[model samples]
Target: MITQSGPSPDGYDPRADRDLPPASGRGDPHRVPEHFPGVSHHEPIGLRRRLALNRMGTFDWDLDRGFMDLDPGALEVFDLRPDEYDGAPMSLVCRVPPEEGIRLDAALSQALQAGTSSYGAYFRVRCRDGTPRWTHSQGRILHDADGLPYRIIGIVREASGELADSALLHSLQKERQRQTVMVQQVTVALSRALSVADVTRVLTGIGGARRFGADGLLLGLTAGGRFEVIAVAGMGGDVPEEMLTSQLDDTLPLSEAAVSRRPSFLGSRGELLARYPRLRPYGEVLPTGSSSFLPLIAQDTVIGALGLFTTEPAVQSTEARNLALALAGVVAQSLQRATLFDQERELATGLQATMLPRRLPEICGGEVTVRYHPASVGRDIGGDWYDVIALPQGRTGLVVGDVQGHDTHAAAVMGQLRIALRAYAAEGHSPETVLVRASRFLAELDTERFATCTYVQADLKSGALQVARAGHLGPLVRDGARHVDWPEVRGGLPLGLADAFGHDHFPETQLFLEPGSTLLLCTDGLVEQPGRDISAGIDALSAAFGAGPEKLEELADRLSAHLWAEPGSEDDMALLLLHRPAGSGAATTPRLRLHVHQADPSGTAEVRSALRRTLDQWRAGEVTHDVEVAASELIANALTHTESGALVSVELLPDTPRRIRLEVEDRSSSWPRRRSPGETATSGRGLLLVEALADRWGAEPRGSGKALWCEFVVPEMPEASARVR
Candidate 1:
């Protein structure tokens, strides 16, 4: 027996003979430990046997001297003989692989540096026969009083079974996570696919292969008792032409998968070729890897097949097979949804196209071009539409409108409204009347929907445009000099809502489109972005229009490209561009017309201002005073005497001395008679002024009313000013 008070300052050395303080005077080294009472004296020996039986071992490492003492059990854990390991710890380097040794060292260093009392690590060690065995070690760090680690005491154990279970679980977890991510990403992308083409783009676009963790992919759809290769991806070489389209009975992998409605997994390219001898013709071009073909089945119907190729061994694990099936299920569902959407979109678009004019009528003096793009979100079919109606009297009615919803109901309403507006305009109704009737028609539909619209009754020969709006964006005008102007058009409530609210009055805006000018009417979709201001989009549109090509078709295409280049537009767009080419030979006489409503007190002032502006543009400023005075008198007399609006026209008549003609037409058949007025009484002075101011003034029977006309003689304009406008 030996007695020891404590460990040396260098730290405890387990090999040194030591004894616990004598407990109750018992000094037997092999006796039951003092800490264990009422136990047999053989207990200490039994404890050692139990440890050995459990393949548990102990070690004492002297950090300063780099020496380690391993018990027989630890040697067994490493599959090493007692004589195989030298006293130096480095002697075990041959047993532990380089990476494992580095990892163990780093763990121990971290524990020591962080002042931890213990650490544990699992690593692989080579056996005597060069077989790798799993081993685990748990160590207790011993430090000097100054906190410097000088020794380590720990246990080593055989961990093959424990680590094997843990590794399998970890691998399963990792694979599950990868599968989950792949499915989630693919599902999210396909959720937005609105058509067959859109689905193909998502699955075969850039990074499509990486998205599926596959090196190559092939996709085909079954149609008309045949298979069509809709898309192929990640193939390093071109696909054989024969594979592009084949019958269901064809001896092809994809075709068979589709026909059988079951998945097929091939171990390698050779296996695939061996199974399908017909593929030998293109074996050289095929990818060298394992492959899988999964039939895309929806509602128990096989619609297509998807193939995945990888430059690795066969997908043999149950997890891999399950992942492939799950991906196929997701793709199948998406394809089903996209197919349905495609069919519905086609039907809706067909209906919409049928409602619209098959072709824009060829205008006498201007060209009409139109474009329509449906919403890109899901299966939405918007109500946006455009129609070019050839109204009577050589006039053209350009209409662009959008109903309130994005469905067949809205499209139906749009079609009805378009026809109604077209009919009214062709019947020679005023722009304001046409809109009022259209609003009433929509309201009568008895649906909880409304619509916005802009109707322009254009007199190309006269270069006059009467524009009316119902809660729609104003039209943009591009002049001959490439200048763009968004005229301020007064608006009323939208179609159905106007009738519901009892405010169906849509004011007509007077516009003059000189030769070589373009009037662009488009829906809000063209200039509305998700997170940006609509004004900004409108500004951008203006800039693009101002700088666009001169040809109407080219300009429309360019504008469409500029505004709709990016995807994710939530609404449909309908754009109609009416371009009035510069007069053919000599410039047609420039003319301007305006309407003055009797109910509007400000109509007379607005018409007067418009007259001044038009005169200035036409370089007829010399007679602006006489023309304005006579026009004011005529308009006032018509409004005071008649019960309807007045139509005023200012024309630079192309005759000798270049006379300026002013005509005020009234709906009333009552003609104006020149009458002398009492100086004090303000009665019957209109015709007197017209008579005194004009070189020639008279009244004529026009359509359903009479026209009071006056002409002003002026000198010829400069050649530059009179050049073709």
Candidate 2:
């Protein structure tokens, strides 16, 4: 029975209304009202009654004039009285929410731009009681002879019942789908958690609130009859200290859920405060609306509880409840697994630490520091180790090694190997000999394990470094000027494999560490990261070392702190640092030590080269020729008379008249005796030559051996003698 002024492209014809009864006079049933100029009032009296009964109202809008007229029925649909609205379209805006009004405007504009003949839309209208009601509007565009839109005629009606019958079912289905997706995403994230820290990070990190569709999330664990808060996300205000830890029997909601192993739901914060009045102090900081607390259970054990909060009233449907419970189950499993991994890792790390030296030995003229860090991700211990052994002749031996594999067995092997290496080094064996014996010992063990090691024999008094490696990284040296470099050291096969491969020789490299310099030796773990080239890590380490603090302790701490910034490293690491301080003025004499094997023909030539180099550095080149001749004769006599190799030392004496002192030590007890012989006798002329070329000479008993010594006068260097750059 709804009427329109003109023919509606939406099937409403104005001609049909002409068949109704004629008007008697003013106020007749068949006459249109003056207020509703857009409505065709020629309808029958029964049609008007039927239209009013159905609660359908008609509207006419003049686009050109920017005005609209609503019938009495349309005013009823908007919950407005006849006297409340004007004839303008904007007069009805008070009934529609801002968001709904924007949507309706957009729809109308689209239809006008598209030149559509008709359009329909549904929107929410705010009632007088401040509740939103569903309403539908249908309009047909009317055009003039020029094909331009001049007016619009349509009808408006209440749609609450219609929406209740169809839209409700669709809303329920969408909510179910959302819940399922939440569960799947949470499960997938938890699967990668390997520790308690990892699990909490995944739950409380970015985007956590949106994934769970909650305004707040709180997670806790039960320990020693107390509940400990682990993570909190999306909560407002500061949390009290007492709330972070509470007894299991406390009246707190999370504690109750954990102890009872059940789920509790509260429709609002008011209900929570009413049920548990003890929570009143925390009410201001807690989330509003509804909240749910579910116990985290795994294998029939309650380990903790999880709390979820929303800002709106909860539906309390079966699917929502099930989703919460499923999420709780997934988290419980991950937490339990992570806890076990932590316990095992703790035990393994303790065992690994026990295998290392309890304390580094204090050495004169040098400061030493060591650090051992376990792998950050696994349950098994690694084989990295560090040791400092005090050797004879005021020297120190620095060792860093890693045994193959990560287990208790690896730790045991490392302990035995460390002891053996320490004993061999302390017995005055050379770096090459120490590693060969260590490899032989490991090969003899019943287990099939190998190790990589870098050993440095440091002569602090002489500033001499002899380095040897067995399939390991070479040591790094930082000079007094903060320049860092990695000296080349040749390597052999790894221990236990050296004997199997029939290669037991590890060649030694000689380096000079000036006073105030530092030597660094570490396992590869310190410079190795998964998927990255090792050279990059090495370069980074070198840069950090060059920029570190001057003090040994502070530098060691700074390097250790870098480990916290890098993640996902599966290997353990060991570090050793030795610093040689620059002593007072000329009192610190420059010295050099070179070892000469009994049968090594090249040993003499290498010693001569080292002598030239040391003399050039000290600006004592005036006596180089005499010192070289005397040293050669002494070395030949020792190699000829001693049953073992010799240790040669050359030092610049700091006295009124500076002198260069040379000492050749051998294992033979027989001392050198000056003897006169025939002119052509070659063997007897060695000592004669030493005695004639040196300004002074002597012999002394040095530990199970004899040290033949010589000295030569060296004039003060001229300023012009400095080497050209």
Candidate 3:
């Protein structure tokens, strides 16, 4: 039976026990007297009531009895009704989050098994409203006489109000630091990009995706007021081509961003679909709950746009949007520069192509090919040129040259110099004389540009060559012995520099071409590069030449393909190859022999007729009329000047600049001389007439008499008539 206390004389409810101390008193009801002899039992009971008033709690568990008790404050912290908590430790522990409950149970079990005096833990617990709060609990274990755990008493307090806030602040700070580093990395990557393609590649690769935390990224560039998807990340080939190629006005989000020149965020799939109905299909495919569109602006111009998609709206934080804008700025600047570079490069390439030769000349008994490569860096135009000119008298002139500097000025000077060299060579000047005149011409114009040049004139009939070098690398020759060597030829000062400083004569080198021989002429770019010696380049070229293909065109391609394979080659390159076909005892020129009777002036007519016949047989009728007139003069001179029967020979030199050689041999030791013929003297006019009608005429003394020889140039025939019998 229980009795209720009545009202006291002081007007306080007598139901409240007067002997009981205030709730604030320190006391423990369950403490054994032996353990806490000085503490009163009412003191612990008062402490429990005070903790409950302060919203802090106390709990006690009789481990052996499997019963638990919680103060009103503990029940309130756990958000448990009186009936909900059954005074079982398991029932209270079940209120915690599943993982935290397991952890707390394991801690209690460990303390009980070890018979430890105390243990504490922080864990998550759910309130009656289903909201989670961090709670800290401390408990002490009581043991029985047998040294086994018997009871546990603990205090429980809500910690989330202060402790959780501190942890959240720390996490946010770390995230900010990580974002700063990511932005720095993106800036560095954009800085290294050299071209539009490079920028696009980097932005679409792993670097861009990781920084933005995007599920899909679309990069659209503006050209001619039209927008096109230049690159896409996270969306593989499955992205529709039409979506990538849409015009700027075709879409809402992209156009709106372009017009506003700011970033726009669609926070939910429903909003995106409602605002951009056309993008609904893509939204379904990408499964994006949020998306952002940013205008790529540079120098106040909207050059492009960027679209980023994320599956969860949480990923689209304020920090992420700021990062996206920063990344857009970097990409915009890099892409703008690259786009300009691409345009300029295309224009330069087209201009350079127009300046080169359209076709290479074809020569008999030899093959010729040329290649020109511009600088891989900067503008793709430089001052390098190669030309194959068909000189008079069955000879071909090959030229390769480089002008100082690598700009439009250098290229202009190079073109002028090439034309001047060709004009001088066509005028029948020797290689050295041509360079001397070219140097003078360049100096007079005063373009302030210097040039290095090499010229080689090869005679098709005799296989003889005349080479001249003007501050240029010597030609590499592969002889019939299969030996590759750079001919020993001293070069003069480069053109334009020599005449401006002092007058110097250019040197000429004479060489003969044996069967199966090849000549290679090139600019320094083909052999020289950064961190490499010119000598090493020359040696490497020699090796490449030695191992090159037998075909002349293929060999030129092979050498270029091998040398240009290395990166960072900034100089312009020009290469020319001249190869003589292989075969022993091959006649350089076609010959037709005829014996002329002595003391017969009429034999001159016969010689002309026979020469015309042979020219017809060789399919060289183009020069028949000139050959006849020149032959008639040479035959008449040989018969009238020498005291011997004439041996008339007509030989046709078949090459680019065809020539017909007429030689009339006699037994006299007299060489013909050129003289001004009087109107009355018909005999002296014959030699005069020969010089006027022929391309070149000369006299050589045979064993006893002189052989009067003259050559007439055969004009280039039609393509169909170029074939020889």
TM-score of candidate 1 against the unseen true structure: 0.64
Per-candidate RMSD, Å? 18.0, 20.1, 24.3
Q: What C-alpha lDDT do the candidate models reach, one value each? A: 0.79, 0.79, 0.72
lDDT of 3 by residue, 318-423 (tens): 4455556666666788888988888888888677667767787777668899888878777657888999988887789999999998887788888889889989
Segments of candidate 1 deviating more than 4 angstroms: 1-165, 313-315, 584-725
Distance from true location, Cα of 533 in model 2, Å? 1.7
Model 1, position 599, has a per-residue lDDT of 91
Summarize candidate 1's per-residue lDDT along 386-406 as a digit string, tens digits.
999988888899999999999
Worst 10 residues of 2 by lDDT: 21-30
On a 0 to 100 scale, what is the lDDT of residue 91 in model 1?
Answer: 86
List TM-scores for all candidates, in order.
0.64, 0.62, 0.54
In model 3, the runs with Cα more than 4 Å from the true position are 1-173, 204-208, 211-216, 238-240, 252-262, 266-291, 309-313, 349-351, 362-365, 479-483, 501-503, 514-517, 583-585, 588-725
Against the hidden true structure, what lDDT does model 2 obtain? 0.79
Best by TM-score: 1
